[model samples]
Target: MKIISNKGGKELKLSFRKVLGVAFIIAALICIYFAFLQQEKYIQGNAEYKKIKQTATDTPSDDSKHTQDFQVDWNTLKTQNPDIVGWIRMDPSVNYPIVQTKNNSYYLKHGFGKSYNINGCIFMHADNKSDWSDPNTIVYGHNMINGSMFGNNKLYKSKSYTEAHPYFYVYTPSGKMTYTIFDVMTVNDATVPYTIDMQTKEDFQSYLDTIKKLSTYQMNVPVTTDDHIVTLSTCTNHGRQRFLIQGVLTNIENNNRVGGGD
Candidate 1:
């Protein structure tokens, strides 16, 4: 009887050990799987970045002079993905091609190259015209942990940061336009930034004033309703809230040398 009892205890111990070992192995495999997924995402993002840079640099026109134009090889980009609408470069942080579809949901999971990607592409609000002729052109991107998309945009929450990086550029088929940073604010997802309609100049000016008051940083830049504005918005705190970096069209350089756009 004593021998049988001891044998049973030993068997139980072995079984417990086996269970722990199996659990550890499964946990390790999960870690490895997630690591591989992250690595794959990094590779895809890097490849897209390289392709865009190469296309932008391959213009047959004088490279030095063309740099000033900020001309996008739209034909090539459209060939890859017809959703390609424009490109945006925020000094020292963001340089990305913008995409637009009939709806906003598609690009949240698709790249500018039209590949499924976790990093996603910068996309304009579907409600706005793809030509960027809206009274307020609002663009959205993920606040990626890797600082790839609009992740660095969170830095503008700092007053000093906005002062250092006060402008961003938008290049459309019509022209290259410069937007001067005016307001960086955190607001509920349904606030004026997301829901306002600016049909009249007075309405826009009132909207501007409200956002300016809400801004985390006070910018001396004057914004009138007459100015075409661009709003860069990204999710913060799991989409319950948003961080908006708003800018006014400060300057524009068109192909015909006639600046500004409606």
Candidate 2:
């Protein structure tokens, strides 16, 4: 604004530069406010998961009381939210309850407690059979900055990291399923038909062949057409790009079907 004094009269007028400066300041404050909210949300989301992990999970004692003792208490967890289909765990940091809903978008914005959370939760593809009977099962999570919820999956880009963490487990109500990591790559999400169902053995093999060619690391793990595979996918820093870690089923324990969804 500018003030002009002429012949005992004073007038005020708006200045374009001043107005533009005020707008810039407003925009900056808005950005800062949203950034603060996002950080707080992430903190709350992490805390909630930590609490859930403590309350809804168990570990076998050294004595090995029961061979069939699953790490996750599905009965208790399902009571909290039936959408939680399974649990995924790796040796130290990568551990979370995998949720599934009628559609793919719900869990991407909601946590295990079904609360609004930008950090989201690890979730299975909506089209996938909860029992994991399908030949290819795809899981999704956000590339959280705090290294939670498949954010660590980005580390798989390093061949050494991939080698060091060779296996991860998915615990269903029925049994514990183990998978060996065979391929890791970051690819354009739009081009990859990640949701395509491999109907026939030949089609499955072809799909495997196509992905293996894109792998950053060639870990010598044999994948056959008959085997079941799980694909862990998360967003990369680049827009419309995704990092994937593909694994083949190597082991199954406590095969009896029991508790929770089929």
Candidate 3:
């Protein structure tokens, strides 16, 4: 009887081990499947974006004065969704159409086409001017795990990355403008970067100095009240804190300009 009981206990232990092993295999497979699905979704999204971009570029515009001008097909995009404001492109990652509404929440779960997507469209703060004319235009996007949207935004935390990729471009109906990154920092979501009420030059400069001082990397770029600034804000590890990539409008190529070559 003792021998039989010991044999039964040994068999039970083996069975339990087998069950755990199967469970682990199943969990791993599920994780891989979801990862693949996310990857496919990203690829499909990029393809759609490229298609729209190509069509926009191919369509001729009557304004041939600025031969090197690159303008989004705002007319067509607006027809599909009137909230389409502009497009932003940054190397090594971020390139997407910017959208806006009366409030900031809608695009957090919707794409440029207004389709529901976990990787929400990049959008500007509701209070910001759609023409990128605000003193401090703020844009927000998700820090997706798959490195889509602003997933790679945290790359700016490294000084080397900031030095290598110092500039990004924002395109509006008026023209294309380049912004040189001046500071990148992680701060509370309610910090000064979110403030747009700096009416005085001194006030704005003070705000700028505060952010510049908070930067992890030091930069010599000059920022002035005359310059239009864009702030790209995304989530950091902390729930209430955000990572900000702040840039100053360095150059503008108005569609009306006539004598420049790229």
Candidate 4:
């Protein structure tokens, strides 16, 4: 009887331990599912929020509604961002502002929250060139979310997409400017000419040569040492390559009424 009692007690304890283990496993699975759901919700919310905020800007409103006071034509891009030269507009346009960041921290900092794409995202330099004034300004963004960021970057690869959307409207903070898309290139990240070698005439010339050699755009712009430019960089090929589109400052003369083109 004693032996039987001991054996039964041992069996009961083992069964209890097994039940607790199963409960733990079930709880862990539930937590993982909720985490996934939350992440999806966050991304969706971010896309939606940006759209809504842009509606407020798109609607005609008082001049004071703008971040700056320089715009006469409310629709003008110059009035939008004093530092912004032009914006990238897409087919399935987000109906919102293409976000601008002042640092790489936006993604890591959750500046865009769930809307942020870790695969590719926007980054900026506080003192780097602005689209309007600099002969060559560099604005960096990413492509991921299965190429949504730079994935559509491949859109430029299509000759038809290039022909259909030949002109990308650029509005500089200095004033509204137009950038005739003249160059597109997929380059190694090591060729970091845009970020470096801006200090001297020699450096700038080398930078220009590198781009000219690699440009996929058939048409060419007359870029002089005096000319300012804009460089849009995004990650491609899983961060191994950089998809870059460069634009020259063209016809800046049309943007004077807003006191731009400085």
Candidate 5:
């Protein structure tokens, strides 16, 4: 009887081990399945954006007058989604249509096609004028792991990256604007303030000084209260911190195609 009982206990232990092994395998399979689904979602979102880019944007010819002139067909593009305010491009990595809504949260989950997507489209701050006339226009994007959106934004923290890609272009409905990157920094979201209403020169100058001091490297790019700057913002670590790339408007080429929010 003792021998039979010992044998039964051994069988139970083996059965328990089998159960755990099966559970582990099942869990792993579920994880892979979800990961695959996420990857597929990103691919689909990217395809949608690529279609928009090819359909509505083109490279400027040699005769183009502006250094940063990239032709954008705002008329046709807006028909697809009127929220599109402009096109933001940083060669070899970042290029996407910029969108602005009444609030900033919509584009954080939606694409240019207004479809639900994890890799949301690039967007302007809610308070920013869609015309890009603000003293400091702020742009926001998700730090996608796949290097889409503003995922490469953090790379600007490296002086070498900025040296290689010194400027980024924004094609507004009215013109193509060139912005020279001056500073890149990361700050606690709560510690530093972000504002679109720098009504006074002193206020704006103070804002500029704060960011310049926070910058990780000195590029000696002259920026002052008079300059119209663009701040490209993205998350660093789950939104607790924020990474910013500040660029001062160096040049503007008016194409006379006027269309944007007030």
Candidate 6:
């Protein structure tokens, strides 16, 4: 009886050890699975951080700065067109998709319909100033969330903001251009003029007058008939309002300017 009891005890102990070992293996696998999941989240967060490093033009949101080292070699990536000269940098992160394109979103890779409105870019020939390719260009961008997309709407309340960050540079495959920000305005289409005639001297003057009246800050910019104007617009007030920021092209030839956009 004693021998039989000893044998049974040994068997029971061995069974318990086997059970314990199996449980440990299962627990370890669960832990490894969770660790992998956490790594994926970390990767996504890092991508977001780098993507938005330069969303703000003036101040550093956290510790990162908004300027990018300019390289004209990237101009080869730009679609070929005289009217669609080059891309402008507002901050290194946000490259205002430069183009003379009214039909598409300035050769932008994503955003537009993918992240913004589907009707990305369309030609607008405002009356006097120039065509959609006019020296002074007025184009609208869709309102996007993350605020970094085309959240140009944020400019309306930023009178002090624009003053602090007053200029951005343009880099073309062929030449570089400089621009000084002069006006930031918010308006609803008071006159439903066609987009083609939007730049007509008469229309442009009215447009100028309207913007000046709505300007939150005083602008000392001298925009002659010769200067090129580029306006970036986006939705505001839940798409009820539009925000406009205007700048005159300095036509800086010989690459005399330092460009990273902001």
List the lowest-lDDT window of 10 residues for candidate 4: 63-72
Backbone clashes, candidate 5: 0
Instruction: Estimate, for each residue in 1-262, the C-alpha lDDT of model 5 and write its tens digit.
Output: 3543588889999999999999999999999999999999999888988788678876444322233344678888899999888888774467788999998888898988888988898999888988898998889989988988898777788898888778888887778788898888787763443677888999988887777678777677898888899988889875578988888888787884422210
lDDT per residue, candidate 3, 17-130, as tens digits? Answer: 999999999999999999898888777765665566676543224332223444566688788778887777775666677889998889887777777677778899999878
Pick by TM-score: 1 or 2, better one:
1
134-252 per-residue lDDT for model 2 (tens digits): 88898998988888888777777888887877887888887788889888888888445385577799898888888878877768899998999898889988999888888889888
Residues 1-262, model 6: lDDT tens digits? 4544588889999999999999999999999999887666445433442342233112234322434344443322332233444555563234543444444444233321233223232222233232224655655555544444355447545666766666765555455666777887666643221133444577666656655677766567787645667776666764466666777776574552334434
| lDDT for model 2 | 0.79
Q: lDDT of all predictions, in order shown?
A: 0.77, 0.79, 0.78, 0.53, 0.80, 0.52
**Ordered list by lDDT, greatest first:** 5, 2, 3, 1, 4, 6
The TM-score, computed over Cα atoms with residue i paired to residue i, of candidate 5 is: 0.89
Tell me how candidate 6 scores on lDDT: 0.52
For model 6, give the 10-residue run with minimal summed lDDT.
Answer: 110-119
What's the lDDT for candidate 3? Answer: 0.78
Judged by whole-model lDDT over C-alpha atoms, candidate 4 comes out at 0.53
The top-ranked prediction according to lDDT is 5
- Regions more than 4 Å wrong, model 1: 1-18, 56-70, 256-262
TM-score of each: 0.83, 0.81, 0.83, 0.60, 0.89, 0.55
* Model 4 C-alpha lDDT per residue in residues 76-126, reported as the tens digit of each score: 333443323233433322112333456544543232333443433343444
Per-residue C-alpha lDDT of model 1 across residues 140-244, encoded as one tens digit per residue? 999887788898888888878788778887877776788888888888876787744678878887887787778777688987767788889999976578899
Model 6: lDDT of residue 108: 35
- Total residue pair clashes for candidate 3: 0
